[model samples]
Target chain A: MGGSSGMTITTARLLRAVTLVVLLIFLFRPETFEPMLALLVANNAPAIYNQGSLLSLTISHLAIAIAATAAAALISVGFAILVTRDFGREFLPLSRSVANIGQTFPPVAVLALAVPIVGFGTKPTLIALFLYALLPIFENALTGLTGLAPTVREAARGVGMTGFQRLLRVELPLAFPVILTGIRLAFVISLGTATIGSTVAAPTLGEVIIAGLLSSNTAFVLQGGIIVAALAVLSYDGLTALERLTARRTGRVATAV
Target chain B: MIASPRHKVLPALDKLGVFIAIGLLATLGFAPLMVFRANRIVLGETVDIAQAMPPGPMVVLLASIGVAGVAALLKTSAMMRLIASLAAIAVLAWVVGVSASFLVEGADAVARASPASGFWLLFGIFALMATDALTRMDPKPSLRIGLVLLAGLALAAFLASGIWDDLSVMREYENRAGSFAREARRHLFLAFGSLFMAALAGIPLGILCHQVRAVRGPVLSVLNIMQTVPSIALFGLLIAPLSWLSTELPILRAIGVSGIGAAPAFIALFFYSLLPVVANTVTGLAGIPANVSEAATGMGMTERQRLFSVKLPLAFPVILTGIRIVLVQNIGLATIAALIGGGGFGVFVFQGVGQTAMDLVLLGALPTVTLAFAAAVIMDALVDIMRPSGVQKGSQ
Candidate 1:
């Protein structure tokens, strides 16, 4: 019986494995020479380099993103601490409710409402990104802090550590790895959301693509898209590396259980 | 009966302050009209007739009545209070009959003056104050109250300001109506369709990946890669191939296949949906205890039976949760599809942005957001239904 189950599993995996390879091959393959060439030309180094406006816009987007991420992290960790403490159980449902509501309010709607008051540009975009990134960060921090073995916390308390001291030395240190994972997720999401800021004319990689779409310039669109994708991938991978390094350095890899 | 004098006085003062704050906010909200007068402007001018045509004192009187109604309701059931407040405001609105005037004036003003004038600074401050007052009332304030207050304020402001006189606002709506409808239909179709497709493709793959260690590494990596692709860029990447196909295939060309519409939008959204669906499915399936499957096998069940009856039933909730995530994400991302003409509410959004018409944009966006919220609520209900009753009981 086990053997048959194993075979079924293997067959399924093999099918997916093959399909994935085929997809990659298709994606990377140059299907149309002219379009591809056009895409390259539109995204050529000189045009991008000369576009000071685009470059500054991109910088501003990143700056705002960083600020938003920082805010999300602080709020999430604070909420996480509150929820994980003994006094926090009463507030768990409240925290979940907040997160649920946050998720439901689409960032675009937030942007629309904010534009009239904030008067466009980076501030509204930052607020939207911050709200959008809240749930994941909060969830991860809560789960990370709570998922720690009770015994470890108990041991810290038994040693005469105060509540704050216990949290800093034990709970936080242990939760850092999981919290980092959440940060990584939030970072990736924020990167994508920042592109939406382009609609408000806040400038980012999205400007190139939006311009391309409006003008029907396929090359410009593709080139801009490629760079954005590269940036996402680079950031995702970079965060993963940072997470792993932190995990290793803190020796949480061994104590994770 | 033996309450301290200080405590009694404090409650009275608190109530008094609430009333005062509400009144002050309402007065300040209408203060913008003091600077401007109602006057007609020729079409194509920057100054809108709406700005020129201020509401008469009658409208202001009605608004004050509405505000009083709202304040009174604040002490009772927040939900009932909100409804009462809204009813008062709506009644006031009908009494004033300024909506038509506002629309006409707003259009003229937008045509004549820069569209930005319609968005006065006081309008925002008033909205913020009203929202703050509503939210601060309770530990968990009624969403209904908040909505009613916002709608009441918006209607009151528009009527009072006389910003709606211009026919251009209506004309803009009508001109974009066809495109907007088409885009809306396209977005709804793609958002739901892509999610449905993701489930069909993702669940089986997830089951397989969980069962086979060898397949896990590559499958996970692919899923990760999909997740890492920023949404706009993903759509950008899709345009080239889809466009090529449109040209290469006669059927596609005849169908009016284009690079910037539904096809590319659907494709990009579909690709994005896969990662969450697949990841959730795998995680859910993998989490099922080993002994449960072992017992099913020992009972002489076939592999298919084991999956359907044993594994799937057990993993159903987790699978649904993944679907929930996909659905919510799709609703939000569907807006981006508007960038490519996939339509839905995004048509109004982008057009409004381009024209700088905040009202028209709000009309489109408010519904989109409401739809998303409704969708989320429905999905949450589904998950609740799918959850095993015993598990539900245990969780509680």
Candidate 2:
């Protein structure tokens, strides 16, 4: 009876967390408010909802952000696995070197190199975001895997489980929490880097800022920057909530209530 | 660790593979030369082999082949050997062809040519070298080969372009070498200077925030807010305040300080660096075991003494790590400072893009990338040295 009640409590908490994230998303959707404000400021306020270009731009930016972040997560996890196996220790320094290179190479530089070949667009922007997000994802995955208690792994192996079986059933489940944290970090980074995409003619929130800069329009710049900041903050808060929910689900967090 | 007959046989095979790869590259590299020679006959123009050829790409290709071939020849699986050999051959050929064209035909020709061609050539070479190096017993040799190839490329460019004789900034403008050298030096200087200022301001503030709980929350939140603001907007925000300051203050105006230059640029970069340094410092200090501090206190050490001797010594490594992050971030952001006359490598990058001068952009960008990498390595080395032996032993 107590266990069932506890599960119900957890479910409610998870739902609340989801609601918060959704709220954040809606807040950053410029079509939801930006156009209405622009209209009101330009002249008299209209009662009708305006489905402006801002909606399409926001959707495309979000899609690019998600796709790039997902790709970064996969590559980082694979690299982390390679770093943890029998021959993995020997490659630790090499792995760190590569990850360091990825982080140290500025996204703008990547954009410059990519522009001539990939020719400007969301594709080049996606590549830059992926590379930019690699370090944190890779580091977190490696840290999570290595931080696992050896005894738990040994016990699983002792129970007649094959290495692969033990890895999937025991190690990965245990490491999921940390890996999720990495994903969260990568997601936030992708969101920020997507703005730089606007420079290469890839339409994103950065377009607004760049347009503002060129025209010296502080109102437009403020509108764009504020929306970007709102997006970053909201996304960060969403990730934190997700992290908390994951911890609770995984029985990693000790809740008083 | 002793080398056996197997090792000797492997190295020999690797050497043979390298030679074959280099040979292929040289042949491919000369393909464009052949095309140029044939075209000259049709146009009734004499083909000058010395003028028509670029040996740099060929040399780099040859070097790559030699290194990769030796790696393949080692007593490895047939699959490893085949990949290494093929990669070496492909890379060499591509490098030779591309570099030859780039040297003989020039920048405009390269730009007008197929976009995919140069990328594939460069990508193939980089990939092949990476694979060959990774498979080696000692990766150092492969890295050395890469460095040597880079050096050869640099030397070739210098010799071919006559850049050495006309190294003067004024001379470049007169000779149409463009503003590559002068712009590169300015950007490099800004990157280093911005990094230095960020460190000086950030570290002490980080330490203060770490020591005082009262200031930590507000300081951290402000820093976090600053980071979320995009670079362009941050630069824009500074113009108003800085312009106002210059107008009000006679001293600032007299020094040629304006809204759009170094002063505003530096402030923006420094602001951006605050969060990482402060957050890391607080986290590092907080992470120090409570028992250690208690023990120091029990020993009758003063608060300042305990902080300096015990807590700081223990937390120094993590603190350094945070500083490293701040320094690297500052370097990258400093480039964007050029948008507002911060006058770094970004000037060239933005200007090149604006003017469609890929060469000028590359000149601006490549060194910044190299400098950032070098800074990261130097910081990593410093962190390694400062780390206690106990921590090192435990991590391994």
Candidate 3:
């Protein structure tokens, strides 16, 4: 607590800068992580960075993520809207419980169950990702749609907007930001999660990590992990930027800052 | 949106209920009853309703579905709905039992059988009906808990009745019956051990973040970033550091801290469990009103006294929630530790995946999921119970 205010250095800023530098080092020269990794791992692993092409793994990783996200977005938004509608209102608790159960049963379990019906490779991975992505996206959509400002609703109704028209013109626009936030979260989490796709013989960054683990190759593990982490961090940052823009447009509190 | 009122073909509660009932009955009448298999993993020999099992149990299941439909049409009480739902689960169990008895009794030692798509669909329909019934009833958590236990116990009793001795998953379990207990114990060890370590480290860090203005932002960001790091990658990342530590430090190796096995898995799980616990801790403390603490100060409370008396108690429920989340999540995540030879349920998961034996995988998965669900329910109930009288609305 001594001279805390007097110090010119901002700890948060300093930490962030240091973190960025470390991450950059990890990207360009993963071998540098070797000595540290070597000391920590059980085996005397030699420096061998970029075990596979990070570029390729990242592409496929993003590919799986994007596909999963797009599917999840469509289904979740539709389901949310359906459940929120008059005819479907009674299904809310059922939908909510189903979503909760999806989370309760781990995504890995979903992958296991999926493989039997779908077989190994991208299809099962996609299915698992789709299931894993549902809870967040659906919950957020419900929250956004249901948690509308009453005045906004009243205003839309007063303007002679039909139910569908009010939903499209007013409710959806207001809810878009929250929904976007959900998509963003799903995307980021899915990026990290899709690593497991490698276990099922789907091409992903996890292949490198798994390869590394099997051989006690710290450099390989670092190579795989750094990229995955970096991608997630970048995706998170990108989403935050979009979220802030949405917040500004909507005049809602900027949660992340 | 103005919903058009349709002519009443079925009563209000019975509209969806009756639909489900008819669908269930139709599927049963048309679809195969159960699948007969030579062994695990291969496509099963299909048996239609006439040959599948005795007409007795199938008839009972059919009767239950019909009754649920009729009950839905009537003005039913909570207790009535409960009975209807429980009856549905019971009948479903009996159907499964009868199918199992037929399959097991007919099969040889290596041969196995399981309920095929028709049976699974019947299960799905019944589950939906039961969910609808439960939702309508909206029983108290304790009552719901009791009902779940009762249903679970009934199912367990059926499984133990030796009627299901040849069901693929149980047969798989029987094969590894000795190792199953050991693996289960190891799984619990990993989950609890990591949780223990996480709490030991996280709480103090959370406290430090709360008390120290300088460290909060930096610490939280690091933890956040750590959280975003995927579980597998985190485990991978830990191997080298832990390996080096064990080798370089003889004393560490003496205590069995190596890079590959439980050590790295524990570290990874510990790191993953941190954010929730710490975030909750910080939130719980910050949520305490400044004026309340100021009042405590005016009343001659020391920092420790104010913290324990005001902050800690106020934060206890939230902290417990965080712990609960961590526990449930760890139970699920520990399955991955099997890949690293950490000896948890993931062992079966991987073996199943490798051998293409879905039953073996379920052997591991079902328990993990059940544990997660049980943990969540218990924690939720505990949180409700812990809430102070003024804060809690209902006296459960």
Best by TM-score: 3
Instruction: Please give, for residues B1-396, the per-residue lDDT of candidate 1 as tens digits.
Output: 776767665433233225435654564354332122222222233333234335563455446555644454244444444344445444433422343344344443433222333223323323333333444443222344345456557756864554443333443555567876776777789889999888888888888888887887677666666665567767766777887798889898788666778888887888888877777777677767888889999999999999998888877877887788788788878887777766767777777777666656765776677667767666666676677755321110
Ranking by TM-score: 3, 2, 1
TM match of model 3 to true structure: 0.89
Q: Using alpha carbons, what is the TM-score of model 2?
A: 0.74
Runs in model 3 lying further than 4 Å from the true structure:
A1-52, A254-257, B1-10, B13-19, B22-33, B69-75, B389-396
Candidate 2 lDDT, B234-295, residue by residue in tens:
77667667887999998999997777777777777777766666666666677777888899
User: In model 2, which runs have C-alpha deviations exceeding 4 angstroms?
Assistant: A1-52, A86-92, A253-257, B1-60, B72-190, B289-300, B391-396
**Best-matching candidate per lDDT:** 3
RMSD in Å for model 2? 8.3
lDDT of 2 by residue, A9-64 (tens): 57645754665565455445544544544532324433122323544666787788
RMSD of each: 8.4, 8.3, 4.6
TM-score of 1: 0.71
Per-residue lDDT of candidate 3, residues A1-257 (tens digit):
11123244586346446666776776566666666766644544555544566556778988999999889999999999999989889779978877776777777787887887788988888998888788888988898899887999999999899999988988877787888878887888788889888889888888888888777676677667777877787677667667778878987754321
lDDT of each: 0.64, 0.63, 0.77
Selected candidate, larger lDDT, 1 vs 3: 3
Q: Which ranges of candidate 1 are over 4 A from the true structure?
A: A1-50, A53-61, A82-91, A152-160, A249-257, B1-180, B254-256, B390-396
lDDT of 2 at B3: 53
